[model samples]
Structures are given as structure tokens and as C-alpha cells.
Target: MVTEQHSFITSAKRVIDIEAKVISALASRLGQDFVDACTMLKNCKGKVVVSGMGKSGHVGNKIAATFASTGTPAFFMHPGEANHGDLGMLSKGDVMLAISNSGETAELVNLLPVVKRLNVPVIAMTNSKHSALGQHADVVLDISVEKEACSLGLAPTSSTTATLVMGDALAVALLDERGFTSDDFALSHPGGSLGRKLLLKVSDIMLTGDDLPLVKHDALVADALLEISHKGLGMTGIVDELGVLVGIFTDGDLRRILDARVDLHTALVQDVMTVGGKTTQPEQLAVEALNVMEAHKISALMVTDEARKPVGAFNMHMLLRAGVL
Candidate 1:
């Protein structure tokens, strides 16, 4: 058992070391060709069509997704499928990103003449620039590695990693050049937590109108407590005669008043409340509101308008329920 475990650890470490070296060497190989590829992709009016065979096809799928999500329109096309009428997906004004570690993939090479005839520029990822795929490409990105991380020296391990990294470099370069923002990325990924964080606003989750926990500044601490309890927001907003928010009264304040032996019946809620408490606008992002709550160590906040009037209110529980926590 010990011998098997030791052998497993040794093999894992060796693979990691070799792959890490291969990735590190990629930086030194990036030059004018990388820049030209980025320029071609950025200038392309149509979508980026990525094609490969076998294992390279799998990597191409992910690379295409990264490109699509980062503001660069792209999609993967299996070379085998393309040969069977799917080649219609490629069109004028589009760019071809062909991945083939060997640079001699028969399925991919056969499509070169068709791709070229359509006037589409080809950017090739290969181990040798002198190979057939490279010779046909407008720009050749060398993804060469000394050897595979596979002990048999035949599997596509380090070479695939290099190809994936190169794809990432191209995608990110185009993303940066186009000035893609988080808002753009969020639009592409609208079904997950990331989308909610970027797309949800305080107005979308805040308790408005009748749900707002609000009381007159002249109200007694006892009255404020009643409002807090009725609203179940753990806090109540204290507003002045003009209906402008002036302070906040929370459970924490009640505990402090109890300790001070203040008369809840007669003490004005404004006197004991936190003056000018933390506030957020309806237009603010929920994540930004959460940041304010966390930074101030508070659990609730009053959403105010331009006139400083309490228009809405919410607490940590509301944020959690809205998936903003």
C-alpha cells in the first residue's frame, strides 16, 4: 500500500512540474505573431470559428466559449462535422482559429482550401510553423513543448495545456482591446450567482411603500420598537416633520437604552437613535449595498431618495433571501 501511494504522489508531482515549465515557457514565445492574431480577431466583423480534431476539438470548445463570453464572438466547429456541410457556418468577414498540435491533422488540413477560398483569415495553433496548417495560416502561433507530461511520451498533455493557454491569451487580448467591462461579461452569463451580483440593484430587492419600517423622529423609543417588530426588519427609520430621514433605531440601540435605564415611554427615538445612519440609493448595486453594511458592521440600511426621505428599507435577511449575500 505504501509503495503504491508513494508512486502515485511521485507521478503527480512529476506531471505538475513538467506542465508548469511548459506554461512558463509560453511567455517567452509570445511575440509579433500573437499581436497580429489579436489584431485579426479584433478586426473581424463576424464570429470567430474555431475548429480542431479529437482532443484538440475539446480544448477548442472551451476556448471558443471563453472568447464568446469575453466580448469576442466565437464558436467551435468540429472539423469532421465541417467537412459534412457544417462548413456553411463559416462565412465572409469571419476569422478561423484552427487548433492542431501536429499541424498535419488531415481533417483540419483538408478544410484549409475551403476556408481560404472564402477569404477568411486563418490563425493556426501548431507545434511547427513549417507544417501544412502553418503554411496556410495568416498567423502561426507556436504551441510547442519539449515533451508530453504523459510518461508514455505519446499523449497530448503539455501540448493541450499550451494550446489552451494560447487561446486564453488571444481571448483576453481582444477583450482588453475592446474595453469589455464586467457589465458586458455579466450579460453573457445571466443564469448564475455572478449575474445576480452584477445585475441586481437595491431597488429590485428593497422593501418599498407599506413594507418600509419608518417612524416620526418625535416618536418614543417604545413606538420605534413597535415599528421595528411589526416590520420584522430589525430596525426602523426615524424621519423628521419634512419626512426626511434623520436617524435609525435598531435592536442594538434598544439593548444600550435598556442598560442606561432610559425611559422608553418618554425618551424621543431621535435622541437615542444613530444620527444620520448608513444609507443607500435605489439605483445602487446590491453588492455595493452589502459592502457598505459589512464595512460599517451594520445589519440593516435605509434606502433614501434625493431629498433624504426614506423610500425603502432592507436588512441582512432580505439581502440573503435575494441571493445578494
Candidate 2:
């Protein structure tokens, strides 16, 4: 007479252990068929169309997105919807991957006749090679397991885990075959911080034109400091009359100049400035700016053109605002 709560907890741990072993065993079953599946996808001229029913459909959708973001170009289609007109999403050049733990999902099976008429390649992902979907597919990837994690063996825990692992194995194999790079992945996920770090360019984040804190070298130190304060970037670029950078004046230089008792009003901006100031090019990646800031231990950096003319300025705060830090 075990309590229901105690029984549930025991069953839950057993569920986890069963799925863990199922995933471990799947690694040993990979062979030439896996290589053949990778080949079909790499040579595909059209998109990879993934289909599934119920729980397997949910995992298939995630797998498709992973494939697309990694340069494999894929999308998930619900087989139940295929009968309702979503089958138009497939093309002769496209490869369709159908997922079903039992390989007997009626919705998936109903679409197979039309899929065959279109002459598209079908890769069936199923636990039973003799199941309907597996029997009809051009290539069958066996995902069979001895039992489900559920004590009643009715829930899909272990089977779904194996299906997800198989999908990831396929997606990663294709990604490697295509030499998909991190920067390529970043382009598809621009809203995330990792994407910003990899894809964001300096020009996209840099202040430019009138936003630049620029002052002539002959101006009084007080006037240049005013520009720095107005721009709110803690530093100002000291330029010659031709608008070329001659030097820079930061809060640090201002402190040293004050220590020497230099008259703020009388001193020329050039005399108190830090010459040949550290700068970044507008074409550089924003992440590179982070490295430069770290290396120099500086709070703000001025963006310059190839000719060293000031174009923009920013500090660590901008990185936070951009979600790139």
C-alpha cells in the first residue's frame, strides 16, 4: 500500500534512468545509414521538410529550426496539416523527414501517397522498421527501444528522447559536412547576445557625424572638456583645423594637467592632450572593441575612419544598451 506520491517519485527516477540508457545505447547503433542520411541532406537543392505527429512533432520542429539556423536550410511541417493543404510546402528537390515513435501515425501515413507522387526523398525516423512510415521511406533510421520510461509503458519519455537525439545527430552531421561557422549561425540569431557578439559591426553601434565629440587643438582645455561632457562619453577628440585627429583629452589627462597647475583657460587643448590616442576603426566588429577596452583598461573609445578622423565614441555602457556585453 504505497502512497501515490511516493510511487510517483520512484517512477520519475526510473523514467530518467531508462531514458539516459536509451540515449547511451543509440550511439552504438550508428552506421552507414547515418552517413547516407547526411549525404541526402547535404546534396539537397531544396529545403529539408520535417514532419511528425503529437510529441514527436514538437521535437521535430525544434530540430528543423536548429538545422536552418546552422546553415542547413530547413523547416517543420505538421503532417496533420499536410492533408489540409500544407503539403504544398514540399517540392521535388526537397527531402521530407517523418518522425513517429510507433511509425504508424495515420496522419503521417496518409500523406505518403502524395509524397511518393511528388518523387521527393523520404527519410523515416521511427522505432519500428516494419511500421508503415518506415516501410514506405527511402531511408529508415531505426530508433527502436526495449521499453518506455513509464511504469505502465504508455508515456513517450524514453522514445521521445531517442527521437530528439537522432534528430540532433542528423542535424549536427549535416552542419559539419557543410562547414557551418559560428558567424553563419549568428546571422540567424541576431536577437541573442551571442549573435550580437558575433554579427554586430562597429559601424552599427558607433556614434557618427555630428554625434562625435570633436574640438580643435588650439581651443582652450576648458572648451574641449565641455565637448566631452556634452557628448557624455568621458573623452573628446582633439582635431586640427582640417578635422583630422591631432590628439585626445580624457578625464585622466585632465587630472594630470590639473596637478601641474596648468590654467584651464590659458592652456591649448593639444598641450594637455594624450597624443596618438587609442582608436578603433568603424569597420571593425563591436566585439573587438570589447577586447581593446579590456586590453587598454579604458572606459570609452573613439571610433575613427581609416584616415584617423573621429567618427564616433562610446563606453562600456553602450555595450550593455546594445545587449552585446
Candidate 3:
């Protein structure tokens, strides 16, 4: 059992090493062909149609998704399905990215003629440059691996990893060319945590109006404590006579006052408040607010307007609940 466990570990390490080497060697191969491919994809007036067979087909689906999320319009069309009516999905302005490790997958090769007839340019990701798909393609991206991780050298292992990495390289190159921003990415992934972080403004989930835990500067510490408890935000905003934000008092401040043994009944709220505590704008991204809170080691922040008047506020719990944390 010990020997078998050792053999399993050794095989796993070898597989990882082979895949790693395949990815490492990809950088040096980024030359004129890669640049031309990116330029072609960038200049394409229509969407990208990614097609592949078997394992390559699975990888192509993800590549298409990455392209779509990162500002490029793309979708996966199975090569086998394309000949049966899915071919209607392609148009003259579109570009096709066909993936085949050997570059001669029959189902994919059969669809090349229709792809070319439609005037759609083909970008081939394959090892055999002379293969049917490669020969018909407008651009050939070499995704050849030195060897498979399989001892029999039959299964698609390192080759598939190389193809996937090459697909990522193309997608990212196109992404950079288009100057795709995080906000743009968030728009495509509205259901994910990243979308919440990017698209959700501080104002969207902040406590505003009557929900704000607020007290006048002249208010006693006891008054502030009552406001904090009633609001349940663990803090209260302090405003001056003009109703402008002046300071903030938090549960942490109460702890310090407790240590100092200050008379809560007689202590002025302004005297115990943290003057000029961290503040955020209503329009700022919630993620930005999170960064500020984490940086200052504070739990809550006052949302202020241009004139420094308190408009709204939020705490770490609010951010977490809103999926911005």
C-alpha cells in the first residue's frame, strides 16, 4: 500500500510538471502569428464563433465564455452540430476559433468549407500546421506539446493545457486591446460576488434618512449610546449646530471611555468622539469603502456629501450582507 501511494504521488507530480513546462514554453512562441491573430480578432466586426471537438470542444466553450465576459462577443458552436444547422449561427462578419490538438478532427474539418464560404476568417489552434483545418485557416496558432503526461502518450493531457493557455492568451490580448475595465466585466457577471463589488455603489445599500445613527455634538454620551443601540450599527454620526458632520463615536470609543471611567451622563458626545473619522462618498463603489474600512481598521464609515454633511452611512456587516466584502 505504501509503495502504491508513493507511485500515485510520483505520477501526479510528473503530470503537473509536463503541463507546467508546456505553459512555460508558450511565451517564447508569441510572435507575428499571435500578433496577427489578436489584430484579426480585434478588427472583427461581428462575434467570435469558437468550435472544437471532444476535450478541445470543452476548453473552447470556456474560452468563448471568457471572451464574452471580457468585452468580446463570442459563443461556442459544436463542430458536429454546425454541419446539421448550427452553421446558421455564423455570419460573414464573424471570426471562427477552431481548436484541435492534432488539427485534423474530422467533424471540425468537415465544417471548414462552410466557414470559409461564409467569408468568416478561421484561427486554428493545433499542433499539425499541415492538417486540413490548419491548411484552411487564415491564421494558425501552434499549441503543440512536446509530450503527453500519459505513459502511453495517447490521452490529451499537456496538449489540452497548452491549448487552454493559448486560448487565454488570445482572450487577454483582445481584452487589453479593447481597454476592458473591471466595471465592464462586472456588467457581464452581474450574478457573481465580483459584480456586487464593482457595480454596487455605497449609496445602494447604505442606511439613509431616519435609519442613520446620528446625534448632535452637544448631546451627552448617554444620548449617543442610545442612538447606537437603537440604530444597531454600533456607531453614531456627530453633527454640529449647522448639521455638518463633525465627528463619529463608535462602540470602540465607548470601550475607551469605560476604561477611563468617564461619567457617561455628564460627558459631552463631542468630547469622546473621534474627530474626522473615515468618510466615504455616496457614489463610491462599495469595494472602495471596504478598502478604506480595512485600511483604517474601522468598522463603520460616514457617507458625506461634497459639503461634508452626513447623508448616509454603512458598516462592515452591511457590506458583507450586500456581497461587497
**Which candidate leads in TM-score?**
1
Q: Model 3: runs farther than 4 Å from truth?
A: none
Q: What is the C-alpha RMSD, rounded to one decimal, of candidate 3? A: 1.2
Pick the lDDT winner: 1
Give per-residue CA lDDT, model 2, range 1-325, as digits (tens).
5698898888788888999999988999998878888899898999999999999999999989888988888999999889999999999899999999889999999999999999999999898889999889988888888789877888787888899999899988888878888888898998888998998877888777788888998999999888988888889999887888878899999999989999998999898899978889877888999899989998888888877878888888988788778
Location of the lowest summed lDDT over 10 successive residues in candidate 2: 201-210
Q: Tens digits of per-residue lDDT for model 3 on 142-253?
A: 9998999888999988988998899899999889988999989999989999899899999999999999999999999999999999999999999999989999999999
lDDT tens digits, residues 280-299, model 1? 99999999999999999999
Name model 1 segments beyond 4 Å from true: none
Better of 1 and 2 by lDDT: 1
Clashes of each: 0, 0, 0
lDDT of 1: 0.95
What are the Cα lDDT values of the candidates? 0.95, 0.89, 0.93
